[model samples]
Target: MPASPREEDVLTARELYRFYRAGEEETLALRGVSLRVRRGETVAVVGPSGSGKSTLLGCLAGLDEPSGGEVRVDGVRISHRPETERARLRALHIGVLLQTRNLLPHLSVRDNVRLPQRAAGRKPVTSARELLAQVGLGERMDALPRQLSGGELARAGLAVSLANSPAVLLADEPTGELDGETERMVLAMLRDRAAQGCAVLIVTHSAEVVRSADRVIALEDGRTTAATAPAGGAVPAEVSDATG
Candidate 1:
């Protein structure tokens, strides 16, 4: 049986709504969307383009405020707070990996991973070197973002995202640009993090990502349509064990 929400849920959103207005036009990007990601689970959010996937991720991560509703991380309210407060909460509990990549071109891989630790003003649960090593980039820690190849850059970005040992990891189209093999590798690493007790949520259209997730949530026309197990179920044991 699944764990109780009160015991294992690390990320929660209820009745989320997002609206944008310009002059006489009003657009609703998200309409009363809600979901939960439990500790040590991998959830994939899948939907067609313009179906509010990005908006949902933004609100969940506290990067964008919902027009009406609430978001909580580790049982603390994150939405409706002032930007500074929201940022503080995000730094402490949320790690976001965007499709465009989350690294700074000018910073070395190690420094990029350390940035969130500095912002949180707390000791990292894992050191920068350890994170890079876990992602198979130990020798590339001193390399700049621009110097790394595609797969290396992706893993480096992931290391940065995991630096603070966030309770929830929100990834937007995390493997959109990777080749099939690399995508599998990255998904394996993400699952490894989940195994270590971090709730991981990925927004993507990738079939591989959906297959790797423990559960799949589908969105359509700005609201949740259904929640189901992946067509192929969870990642295979072989894939899950390739995190190194």
Candidate 2:
């Protein structure tokens, strides 16, 4: 049976498993991992390389399917669905930030952000331009992915992920490539979003991210454990400019 998420839970995953078959050999990537992220909360998943953090994020975002169990966003099942259905659900309720950065090489930053809004097939509650501005990318809205700096790319990707004002945000190594200052700036933006009631779940290796989270889940050998109890307190400060 599917685990029943609480009314406040915006993102939930239960008993997740993933298997990869390479000819005669099979590899298990996840082993019955389960988690919950409630509205206005931030949770961080931390683990070493090959520990299934990316796999978990992929499953949560509906970009990949679980071999067992399910994922739900806003109370709707996203696992075991058709690709089109998963895509629609993801666009409607989930914002995902990929490690490589979610941008098309040829598209301008504006269009990259616009793509998710178009995919949702609804008039955007917040315009793409406004999102870019919020990330301090207003001046680079017309720039291509290759034209921006590392910090700019991160901010642009964030804008694209937030295009639909989703109920949940799933980020994989969101600030993995930035300097300390730039990473802080990006994290503050993520904190700001969580403050506005988006359930934020980050798969990360950064101690700073883990420190900023309201709770931490540690994954090892495809299993999960509560690494720390919830440290609820005031939200972080507003995001500052990071044009580098």
Candidate 3:
């Protein structure tokens, strides 16, 4: 069956199209978009408002269904699957950090980072404390989400996102709320994740993120404006700047 998708490709979207319909009215959000993010590579999706960035991410992450097209993660097709099945696959292979931080208010930072794996009945690929340390939240692991500042909250959310050590790391505007210094730190952590063999897909409008990515894909009016990447190339290593 077409050899399934290559396991090395952590995320894939083929001819993706989406439309929202309401009482005979339709809004096209994406049109025939296709891309792949390979293991250890970082790809940036950059576009203006209403350019289908978020919609495209949703489809790729198995969070939304496309009117037409398919999405696969690590060789398994996740598109059009049952929501429960999608959620299971996401817990096992996908890490998402959208605009709203996905942190539990009641849980301590360490527990929040451990929640995903625990919910899935799987051991964490990395320890909560070590992962938090990597994201510069080592000391804040005992604190609640409400006790964290904006930057700290972002860091905590990021730690939680990596709890299961997902194969495909999808981030939307991860540095949007951070100061310049904190932004640099977060970006550096993402790069480090890429270095460790995670396929990093980031939807962002930041010039810094675009330049840091190994490839850049731009969308305009629900279509691809540009995509630049070397075929089958491995992303290079990067230094972490998370040291406080």
Clashes of each: 0, 0, 0
The lDDT per prediction is 0.86, 0.86, 0.82
- Estimate the lDDT of model 3: 0.82
lDDT of 2 at 211: 68
Tens-place lDDT per residue, model 1, 34-146, is 88999999998877778899999999999899999899899999999999999989999999987675999999999999888899998887999999999999999999988
Q: On a 0 to 100 scale, what is the lDDT of residue 33 in model 3?
A: 89
CA shift of 79, model 1, Å: 0.5
Tens digit per residue, CA lDDT, model 2, 129-171: 8999999988999999999998899899899889999999999
Report the Cα lDDT for residue 224, model 1: 89
RMSD of 2: 4.9
Model 1: lDDT to the true structure: 0.86
